[model samples]
Target: MTAPHPQAARHVRAVAVQPHWSAQDFVTAAAFRRWMRAQLDMARPHLNENGVNLVVLTELNGLPLVMRGGAWALRLRTFERVALALFLARLPRTLPILLRERVSPVRALQLADIDANTDLYLTTCRDLAREYGVYLCCGSAPTPRYERRSARLCRQPGLLTNQTVLLDPNGDLIGVTDKVHLTPDEEAGGVDLTPGALGDLRVFPTPAGDLGVAISLDAFRADVIGTLAAQGCTVLLQPDANGAPWTAKEGLPPDPANLRDQPEAWLESSWQVTAQRQIPYAVNPMVVGNLLDLTFDGQSAITGPAEEAPAPRSYVLTAPRPGFLALAPWVTSGEPPALREAGRHRAALSGHPMENQYREATLHADLTLPPATRPAPPRTPHEDALHALLRGEARAARPGRWPWVLAALPLALLARPLWRRRRA
Candidate 1:
C-alpha cells in the first residue's frame, strides 16, 4: 500500500513502456544509464500530460545494466559476437559445471556484478518514481541472495532468485514479489532457483484499489489470478521479457506459452485471466533486441475489462515497434459501468472463486513515504579490464580439462622410463 485513495473526479493514469536493446547497448553502465534515462524521459512527458499516478516497466528491463562489466563484454566484433553468444547460450547449462566445480568462480564474479547493477537499477527506478511522482513497479531481475535456514530441505545452501520489486512515489521500497513457478529448463540449468507458493498472495493495496503483480508466466496460472481476485484485487500487472516469437494465432484468443517458443499454440493465458477476472490488466513485454541471436519482440498493451456490448473481450492496445505506451484514466472505486452488462453478470455468476473475495485496499493504511535517493558511480576502463581478466580465468577453468590432461601425458611418458631404469 503506497498511495492515498483519491475521491470522486480523480483518476489513476497508468503507463506501460516497452524497452528495446541491441548488441551495442550493453557496452557500459553509463550506456545503459543513458538508454534507460532516454526511455524514462520519453515516457515522462506522456505521464505528466496524461496526469499519470502509476507507471510500470517491463520485466528484466534492467538486464542490460548487468552487462556493464569487462572490455571482453564491452567491445563488439564478429568473432567476439559469436563467442559471447555461445557463452550466454551455455550459461544455463550449468549442471555438469556445477557438479565438476568448474564455473563457480565465474558465476560468483558475474553474480556480484549483476547484483551491483541490479542495486543501481533499483535506485534509478526509485528516483524516477520520485521524480515523476508516480507509483512504480520497477521491474524484475535474477539475483543471488542468502536465504534463512529453516526446517525445509536445502536445495543448495544459497541460490539466485528472480524477483520483482515495487517502489512508491517519493522513492520508498514497497513489496518485492518473487517468481513462484520456474521453467523446467531453468531448473535443470544448475542455477538453483526457489519457487514461490500460490497460497502466499503478494497483493498490495494501492490508491487505485488493490493492486497485484504476476511475473512472466505466473500471470497465466488461473489459480494465481483467482487467488488475487479472491483477495479483491482490481488491477493486475503482468511484466514480461519474452525472447520467443509471438506465436499467438491471428484473430484467435491469446494463451500463455510459459515464455517458451511454441510454434503452434496461441499464448492465451494472460488474456484468458483478464477475460475471466473482468479486471483491468496491463501486459508490458520486452521488445526488439538480440543477445547474440536471441531476439525479443515488442507487444506491450493494456486490455480493458470484458464487455458484452462492444465485443466478447475488452479493448486491447498493442505496441509493435519503437515501443508503445498504453494509457487510460481509471476511477479508483467501484466496478466500471461496462461490467454491468448481461454477459459480464453471467460470467461473474458462473462461479469464479476469486470474484469479490475481500474488501478494498482503501480500508488499509496508506503507503506514505519519506524522501531519499541513491546514485551509482560511473564505469571505469580499469574496472572493465580487471573484470575481463576474471572472465578469461573463468573460461580457462571450465570442466573436462583435456588440455591439462594431454599436456601432462608427454611429461609422464618421459619420466616413466627414467624411473624404471633407476629401479632396475
Candidate 2:
C-alpha cells in the first residue's frame, strides 16, 4: 500500500458529502454501491484538481442499507410501511435472535440482517476508498464488532453500537470509533444500541494529520472533544444526522432571550467546540432528505479556528462569524410552511413536489492547519450554560420502557394472523 503524499500532512483537501437518503438507493447492495460511487463521481472534479485526501460522510449513512435484503420493503415507500415489511419478512430469523439476545424486535431486525448490511457497507466503503485514493470516513452504522483476524461478526446480539470506520487510501482499516453518546431513540426508543466506552476513543494518524471522529451527539460533549484534543488530534471530523428541523428551536436555547435554531445549536456544539479546543480544522458532514417517517436536513460545513480568515467564498457562511470554510447550500432555510402546517402527516410531506429537491450537496475545501500561537478564548457564558444543560440532559437520559411495549404490541398484532393461518 502506498502512503499519501507528504504535502497532505499540513494542507488537506477534503470533501464532506451531504447525502439525500432514499429507499431506492438501498434496493439492493449493487444499487447502494452505485449510489455511493455516484457521490464520489460528483466529487471527481475536485479530486482530480489537488487530490482530496479525506472524504467525510454523515452519521447513520449506512443504516438505511439494512434494507438491502428487503427490496419488497423498499418499495413500501414509507418508513413505517418499510419497517413493518422488514419486521414481517425477517420475523422468523429475527425471533430467534430476539429470544436469545433479549433485545427489542427493532434491534433483532437489524441483527437478523447484520451480516449482509455490514458487508455491503464495509465492502462499498473499502472499494471506494481505494478507488478514490482518499482516506474515507465511512460514516456511522449500528453494528457488532467483527473479529480482527477473521473479520467475522462476533454475533453478540444486543451488543450493537453506532460505529464509524476510517479507511486508508489502500482500503486498509485505519481505525474505528464508536459513538460514546447515543440518542434517546438509539438507546431505548427501539433501536436498542449500546453506548461506546469513552476509554476506547482514539485518533487515527493520517497524512492529513491525526484525525478524530465524533459521531453526531458525541461531538456535542465537551469531554469527548477534550479527550481528542489532549491526544494531539488536528482535524475533528463530526459526522451528523440531525433528526429535527434545521430552523426549529433547539431544546432550551442557551440564551432564553435569544433563541437559537438547529443550525445555531449545532454550531455551538461542533464548530465552537473544536475552535475552543484549537483543533485547527473540523469537517462536519450532514445527512439530508427523508427515509420513511424521518426527515433529516442540515447544511454540511468545513470549519477552522475563527482567527484564520480566508477569502470570502460563495459557499462559506460569514454572517454567523467567519469560521466556516465551506457550507453546503440548503434549498430552504426552515421547514416549509406546508410541512409545518401538515405536521407529522408523512403523505403530505412526501407528496409535495418540491420535497425531492431538498438538495443533497457536496462541500469541498482545502484546509491548512497551522500551529496555534494564541490560546483559545475562554468558554463564554452561553457555552457554559449550554454545556451544563447538555450534560444534565445526558445524565438524565434513560432508555424509555414505553418503546419496548409499543414495539412488542405491533409484533403481537402482526403475528396473530400468521398463527391463526397455521392453526387453520
Candidate 3:
C-alpha cells in the first residue's frame, strides 16, 4: 500500500459544529437529515483540502426531533399553547408511557417515540459518517437500551439513558457510551433521565487516538475525567448544551465566591479538565438556539495542552489563553442589552424577534496526539457492586404507576380517536 498521508500518523483534522436548534428543521426526518448534512457542508471547504478524520456535534443535538409531527404547534407562539398542542398530538403514544413511568407529560413524550428518534439520530449519523469518510460523534440523545446482534438495532425496554454513539468511516458503530452524571433537571425535573453506571465507562480505539466521551456535566466531574484519563484516553470529546443564559452565573460553579459567566465556567470544566488530566486533546461542541421554553448557548472549542501551540487559523477569545486550539464565534457577538431587560421582566427571550438570527458555526483544527499513557486498572469488586446498586435503585424508582387524576381529560379527548380506529 502507498505510504499513508504524512499527517495521518501523528495528526488528525477535526471539526466541531455548533448547531442552532430549529423546530422547522426537525419538522420531518428528511428535514433533520438535510439540516445535519448542511452542518457538514459548512465545513466542506476544509474537508476538501484533505479528508477530515473526525467531526463532533453538540449534546442532545437530536432531542428536539422528539417533536417530529407537532410542527403545527409552531403556529401557536405561546409556550403553554405549544406544549399543549404537542401533548395532544403525541397523547396516544405518550399516555401509555406517562401511566407506566409516572412521569411528567414532557418526559413521557420523549419516551413515547424514543425508538424513532434514536433511529433517526443513528441512521443520520451513520450515513453521514460513510458519506464523508470520517469518524463521527453524533452527540447524545435520550435512548433506551439497544443491541446490534445481527447488524440490526434490537431495542429493549427497562432502562433509558442519555447515550452518545461513535461511528467509523464505514458506517459501523465503534462504541456507545452513556452519560454517567445527570443534571438536576435531567434527573428530578420533567426530563427524569436515568444515569449511566460508572462501571460501564469505556474508551474506544481509533486512528486519531483512543477516544473517550463525557457528555455535558460528566466532563466536569473529576471521577469521570480521571477514570478516562487513567484508561489511556488521549482525546476527550465533550458534547454540550447549556440550557441557561450564556452570560448568567453558572449553577454549578467550581468556586461559588469567584463565579464566572457560563462560557468561562464551561472552559474551566472542559479545557481545564483535559489539561489537568494530561489528555493530549479535547474537543467541545455546543448546541445553541431555543427549543420551546428552553434556550441553549455556548462557544464551541478545541483544546490541547499548554505546550502545544494552536494553529494559526484558531480563533482567539477575549483573553488568549493557552491550550485553546480553536474556538467558534459565539452565536451573538455579545448578549443584547434588551435580552437582559427582557429577562428582568420574566419574558421568554427565545420568542423575541431578534432570536431568529441565532447563527450556527463550525470550527476546524488539526490535533496531534501524544504517546500513549499507562493502561487503566480494572474495576474493583466494590465499584461493580456500587454500579449494580445504582441501577437497582433507578429501576425501583419507576415502580408501578401512581394514579394520574389529571390525565382523565386528555384520555377523554382521545376517546373519539380510539373509537374511530376500533370501528374501522
Candidate 4:
C-alpha cells in the first residue's frame, strides 16, 4: 500500500466512505472511540492501497457519539409529554452536562451529550488523520464551540454552529467552515444555531488543489458556490447528512431522511455553478440507522467540471444500505477530466433532465450496495409546517398567534381608510 502522498502541487486521490451508524453503536465515549478507530483502520488500508491522499466523510458523522450518554432520553416516544418526563428524570445527569445551566430538555440534550461527543469526535478524527497520513475533512457536527475564561474555569457554550473541521495529513487543525443556512425545519427542530461569516469564507491549499468546503444546503445556494470559485477553489468538498425525508408529501425530501432516490438539490445547483464557473465538486453523505426518528442516506459522488468532453461523467457510489458501508474510490485532479464539457444550467429545486444523466465514469473502484429502505412514519402537522416554511410556501405557523393577528390586520386596514376619509 502506498503512503499518503507528500504534499505537493499535483493531483491527489480521495475516497469517500459511508459509515452506517446508529444510537446502538455508541453507548459510551470510550466505546465510540474504539468503534470509530476500527472503522477508520479498516478504511485506511484500502485508501492507502488506492493511493488516496485525502478522504471526505459525511456531515453529523459524530452524532451517534453524542447519543452515548443520552440514549435513554431517546428511547421514550418523541412526544413532548414523554420528552418532558424523561427530561425531569435525567436532570441530575443533564444539568452538569449543560454546564450547570437551566434550559429546556431538548436544548439540554443538544448542549450536553452532543457537545461531549463532538469533543471526542474531533480528537479521534485528528488522531486518525495523522495516523493514516491522509488529509481529512473529518466530517461535521452541530458542534457547540466553547469559550473558557481560564484553564481552571469551566467552559461555556460560545455558539452552536453546524461546522466542518478540516485536518491536514499531519493531523493539524488547519481550518473550518460553518454552514450558513438552517432550513426553517432545522430551526423548528430546535437547532438554534448561528451562520458562519461570509467574509471569512475560504479555501484550503492542498496537494490536490485548493479545497473549498461547504456543508449540506450551503451547496444549494448560487452565491456560496460562486464565492468558493472566486476564492480559487478548484475542488469543492461537500459534507452532508441531509435530514430531508425520502418521501415528503410535496417538494423534495426533508433533512435527516434525505434519500438517494429523491431529487438532489445540490446536484442541480452545483451543476449550474460548475458549468458556469468551472469547479469540480464532490459530495459525501451520512447513513444513519433510525436515530431521533431520523433516517440518513448516503450518495457519495464526484462531479466533473463542464467543458470540452462529449458527455461529462459523475463518479458515484451506490448508497450504503442499512447496516452496510458505502465506499467509493475517487482520484483528485487539478482539473477534472470533463473540465471543458459544458453543463446545462437548471434551478436547484427542479428535477434533473434526462439528457443530463451522464452516469458513465471511470471504473477505478467498485461501488457498494445501499441499505434496505426504512419506511418513514407519517409527518406531524408541526413537521409539515416546518417543511412548508422551508419551501417558502408559508410562514412559520404559530398556532395561537396567527389567527388573532390575521383577524386584526383586516380591521386595522379598513379603520385606517375610514379615519382618513373623516379627516379629509
Candidate 5:
C-alpha cells in the first residue's frame, strides 16, 4: 500500500521502545561490557540492510535525515579501561561483541570536561550516522544542546545559522528547508541561546516513501509544524540538543521537564496536524546529561494511525538504560495528584489539551496526556479567604467567599467591642 503523502498517513501509530539496564550494569566491568554488547545485538536485528531501523529519530524539528550507530565501553576512570580490568575474569561472552559497536581509537573525559569533549563526540556522531542506515544520534556530551551556554552564544546574529534537508536511500537528498522561529534568552546550559531567522520548507521524493523534514529546534515551532503539515510530510526528523549539564529532576531550579515541555507542546500541535494530514512524526530524544551512556530515554518515538485511534502503540523503540524513555501512545486511566494541583494554578481549568489532543496542550504542555490536566483543585476555605484578601486584583469566579468575609467581619468587630464593654 502507498500513502498519498506523509500527511496522508495520519492513520499512523505511536510506539515507544526502550532497553531496561540494571544498575549493576554500570559498576561491574566484565558484567557491564557484556550487557552493552547484548543490548546492541538486540537492537541490530531491527536494522535494515542499509543499517536503518524503523525507529523515528527526532527532536523539535530538522530538515533532512541521517543514519549511524556505534558504542563506547569505558570504565569510570582511565585506569579502569587500561590496567585495572576490574571484572574481566567474570564477564560473559557478550562483552567483546559490544566493543565492536564502537570502533574506537578511544578518548576519555571526566564529567568536568564534557564541553571539551564536543569535537570527538560529534565525530563519533558523524561516524555512526554513516555506518547505520538510520540517523544515529550519538555522543553523551552537550546533548539536547538547546540549553547550553554555547547554544546561548548562537543568539548573537551571524554567530549561528542552520539548514534542513531530506535524504534518500542512496544518500541523495530530495529537499532542503530552513527554520522559521527563534526566540531570545532561551535557557541553555545555565545560560541562554539567542534567536535567528526563518529557513526553507518543502517536500522531497524517496524510494521507501516521500519525506518532509524540519532541521532545527527554533525552526520547528508551532507555525513551522503547521506549515509542514499543510504541505504534508509523512516522516519528520528533528535532531536537537540541550547542551546543559545533567542531573536528576529534583536538582535543577527549573525542572528539565519544563525544557522538555517545548517539544511535547509542539508535538501536540504538530501531531494533530500530522494525523489530520496522515503523516508520522519521528522526534529525536533529548539528553539529560553529557555522560557517555547510550541509555536512550522515552524521547525518540514514531507516530501514525492505529486500528482504533492514534496512540503510543505506533512507537518503535526507546533509548536503552540509564537514559531517556519511550512510551507507546496510550491514555492514562486518570490524572495524577500533581496534575490536579497544577490545574488549580491555571487562571482557568478544564477543556485543555495533551500530546494527543489540542486542549491538553493548553499553556502547560507536559500535563496534556493521561490524567487530563487535573481540574482546578477544590479550594480550601482558608485558601479561599487568603485569595479574597489578596485580590487587590483577585477575580475568583467563586463569589461565595466575598459574602462570607463580609458577614464575618461585622460579627468579628462587634464581638470584640462587646467583650471589651463586659470587661469594663
Candidate 6:
C-alpha cells in the first residue's frame, strides 16, 4: 500500500465547537449517546470527507468512549463557568458561587477535592495537533475555581492552553497561530485567563517555514491583522464559539439578533475584511452544531479578508470540522496579490481556453526601484490631476491605437452576410 502523504503536504483545515451545555451530574450512558450522535451529525459533512479535518468540539476535547453494540456515547460541556460545573452544569445552584467574600479553610479544603481536567484538556489538544493536524480546544483560560485554590489550578499543567503553529515535514510553520486568549469560563476556576500576555506573538521555527502567530479573538482586529501580516505571518488560524456573536441586522449598533458582527464585542469577538491592494480579502465564519443536540450551535470558522479588493476573487473558506481555510501556494495564485488602490487594475484571469492569447508581463528598465527606500504612496490630488492631464496630452499626441483586428476577427469567424448591404 502507498504511504500517506508526508505531514504538512498541503493546506490544513481545522475547527472547534462549543455546545451550549447544561450541568450534568449523572453517569448514565444513554444520555451521552444521544448527545454524541447529534454532534457527529452536525460534523458529518466535514467528517465524511476523505481528508483529515481537525475538528474541535467543546465536549470532551478528546472523545471519551462508546457503549453497547457499536453505539457511540460522549459527554459534552461548555467550558465550565466552574470546573465542577462541567459535570454539574445543569444545576446552577450546585455550581460554586461565592456568597461570602471570604471562606473558611474547611470550605477551601472542600474546593480542592474536585477533579481537574487541566492535563486532560491540555494533553488532548497536543494529541490532536499531532494526530489530526486539526486542533479543537474547548473550555477557556479559566475553568472556575474557588479563589483560594486558584494557585494550585495554574500550577497544574492544564491551566495554560496553547496553539502551536503547524510545522512542515522539515519543521517549518505551516501558517496558523494557537489560541492565546482564554475565556472567563475556561479560566473561571483558576489560572490568569485574561488576553494579552508575554509571548502573545510567538514565532515557531519549523522545517516547513518560520511561523508568526497570535491567539486572541481580537488578534484578527484590523490593526492586529496588519501588524501580523507585516511581521511575516503566513497564516492566521483563530478558533471561536458560534452561539452568540452572529449578525441579526445591518446598519445598526449591535444588531439585537446577530452576535457575531455586533459593535459591543467588536474588540474580542468579531471579524472583518480589509484590502491593501485589491487582492481579494474575505471573511468566512463556520458554526458547528449537534444534530443529536439540536440546541447545540457550531464553532470554528475562517473570517477571510473582504472580497471587494482589486482581484475580485473570493477570500474566505471553512471546513468547520477537521476543517480549514487555506490559500494555494503563491505559484498557483500567480503574482503576489496585495491591497492595491482601487482604479483600472485588471483582475486575475485564469485557465481560459484562449488564456495564452493574452499577454504575459515582460520586464522593463523603467520598472527599476525608486530612489526612496519605500514604495511610492498613492498620488496626491494635485499629482493625480497632473497625471491625468499628462495622460490626456500623451493620448492626444499619439492618436488612439484602436485594434482594427478585434473588429475584423468576429466578422471572419462568423462569415455571415453583411447586414442590409448583402440583403440588398
For residues 148-237, write the lDDT of model 5, one tens digit per residue.
131121111112223332332233223333333322212221112223233345544333333454443432356566655555455554
What lDDT would each prediction earn against the true structure?
Answer: 0.45, 0.66, 0.67, 0.49, 0.28, 0.27
Per-residue accuracy of model 2 over 131-178 as CA lDDT, tens digit each: 889888888888675432122223443688888878778776667788
> Residue 97 in candidate 6 has what lDDT?
18
Tell me the lDDT of candidate 1: 0.45
What's the residue-level lDDT of 388 in candidate 5?
29
Candidate order by lDDT, decreasing, is: 3, 2, 4, 1, 5, 6
Shift of residue 366 alpha carbon in model 4, Å: 14
Q: Estimate each model's TM-score.
A: 0.58, 0.78, 0.78, 0.62, 0.38, 0.37
Q: What is the lDDT of residue 168 in candidate 6?
A: 30
lDDT by residue (tens digit), candidate 1, 1-424 = 8897554432566666666555556557676666666666656655645443666676666644434544464344332243334334334432233334333422332343443565566666766777778777776766443221221111222355566766677666556666776653223232234566676555666554356778766775677777777665556777766543232222211323333322112134455555554444544434434443343433455544444113332222221221112322111123334322212222212244432121111000111111111222232332232222222321111223223233222222111110000000
On a 0 to 1 TM-score scale, where does candidate 4 land against the true structure? 0.62
- lDDT computed for candidate 2: 0.66
- State the lDDT at 409 in candidate 3: 51
Name the 10 consecutive residues with the lowest summed lDDT in model 6.
361-370
- Cα lDDT tens digits, model 4, 1-424, are 9897553435456566556555566767777777667656645655645554667776766644535654666565232333344444544544443333444335554554543465567668877887888878877776654432222112234355677877776666656777876654344344445577766567776554577787767776667877887766766777766453222111333454553333234445444445554565443444423343343433455444333222434323222121111223322212322221211111111233521222111111222112212232243332343223223344321111122222222222111110000000
lDDT of 6: 0.27
Clashes of each: 10, 1, 0, 23, 84, 65
In model 3, the worst 10-residue window by lDDT is 415-424
2 or 4, which is superior by TM-score?
Answer: 2
